[model samples]
Target: MKKLQLSLLLMVFLVMAGCSQSETTNTEVNKLKETNKTLIEDYNKLVDKKEKLEMELDTYKEVDENSKHLTTIIDDFIHAAQKGDTATMQANISKEFTFEKQEEWLTAVNGEKNFPFYSDFYKTKLKSWYLQGIDYDKEKDFVRVFARVGYSDGEDSWYFEIIKEDGYFKISDLQYET
Candidate 1:
């Protein structure tokens, strides 16, 4: 009877040990699955962020290119203004621009009167000038380019409003800060 009781106790101990080991393995597997799910979620979020960054980078590149082209256009206009070439200046001006505005430019160029963005006035007054920046208005579908201009007395802010016409950009108006 002692030997039978001992055998029964040994078998019960073995069975309990096996059941606990199996439970531990199941718990480890569940934890691993949860960790894998979290890793997948984190990876997806990174991918989304990477895509958004790429799009923003592309937009900046396009803006840079546009700025370069616009600078060229404005440079040509400034050169024409320095020489008092109305035809070349008119070429850069938008067709939609008013004849009255054209007269203002003509008069300003001839030194008959003062208007903002007169390169001749700039010729006499400005020590140095450069484009500050460009902004696009989506609502109006127009662009404004700011210029950093410093004349003999003081620095002033100037801007040229640009618009697309006939699939090309043209200057429509000029302004100066008070």
Candidate 2:
């Protein structure tokens, strides 16, 4: 009878230990599920943040492709103008511009007496120039670009009219504020 009692006690102890281990396993599983849920939530938030950043980056581009191209052309033209490079300037201008201002456009660096209407452009060296804005004239079918040029004398407003020719943009006319 003593041996039987000893066996029963051992079995009871084993069963209780097994129940305790099972409870501990269930708690560990719950903790792992919570950790996985937290990781997923964090990942989703990061994705949302990334998407927002991309959209903000797009908004920073104020100029479209066409306008951007026009800006580049104007910048190049200004650089050429500073050096009185008639060839480079003419390359950016339209044939009509060349035809309209034939003598002045071709012989801007000839002499003081024969200087172009904007003689100061070829005489006084410029400091800097900045693009103010660009607007499209729907009815006129042209893009009007405004800029400010700073020279040794002072600042002047510059206007450039860009027109589409042969599927490309060209300077139809350009003048400065007197």
Candidate 3:
């Protein structure tokens, strides 16, 4: 009887040890799952942040691409006008170019109206155009330029706009502002 009781006690102890080990394993598995979940969440947040940063960078590039160099176009306009080269002017004007007649266009450059006001203005003979400025509007698909022309009298600023065509640039508009 004594031996039988000892055997029974040993069996109970062994069962208890087995149960404890099983519980420990379950706890460890739960911990690993929780760690994996947290890591996944962190990775998702980082991806979102990276996407936002990329968008902001793209915005900056668009603004830069469309926003500089009015002078170059203006120079083109002056040269075209002085040489009376309609082809050269067309090269810088929008295809659907709109303004009054050429006279009205010239008047604007002279700042005869809403155009800016500057004293000592003179028309360039347009022997050769030199770029003075360039400006663009990214959203509008248009660009403006400023140029110096060699007029019979002297040099002056001429502004013109280029229209976007078939993923290319063309002269479609012209104006002169002081």
In TM-score terms, which candidate is top?
1
Which candidate, 2 or 3, has the higher TM-score? 2
Candidate 1: C-alpha lDDT: 0.71
Candidate 2 per-residue lDDT over residues 76-117, each given as its tens digit: 887777665667777777756442244445333222222243
Error of 2 at 116 (Å): 2.6
Please name the candidate that would achieve the greatest lDDT relative to the true structure: 2
Error in Å for residue 130 of model 1: 1.2
Go through the candidates in order and give each one's C-alpha lDDT.
0.71, 0.73, 0.58
The order by descending TM-score is 1, 2, 3
Worst 10 residues of 3 by lDDT: 110-119
- Tens-place lDDT per residue, model 3, 120-158, is 233433455566666655566566665655546565566
Q: Please provide, for model 1 over 1-178, each residue's C-alpha lDDT reduced to its tens digit, 9 standing for 90 to 100.
A: 9999999999999999999999999999999999999999999999999997797666556656788888877777766654566677778877654222353344333234244334333345446678888987545667788986666677767688888779887887776674
User: TM-score of the candidate numbered 1?
Assistant: 0.54
Model 3 residue 148 lDDT score: 57
Q: Is candidate 1 or candidate 3 better by TM-score?
A: 1
Q: Candidate 3 lDDT (Cα, whole model)? A: 0.58
Clashes of each: 0, 0, 26
Off by over 4 Å in 2: 1-63, 99-123
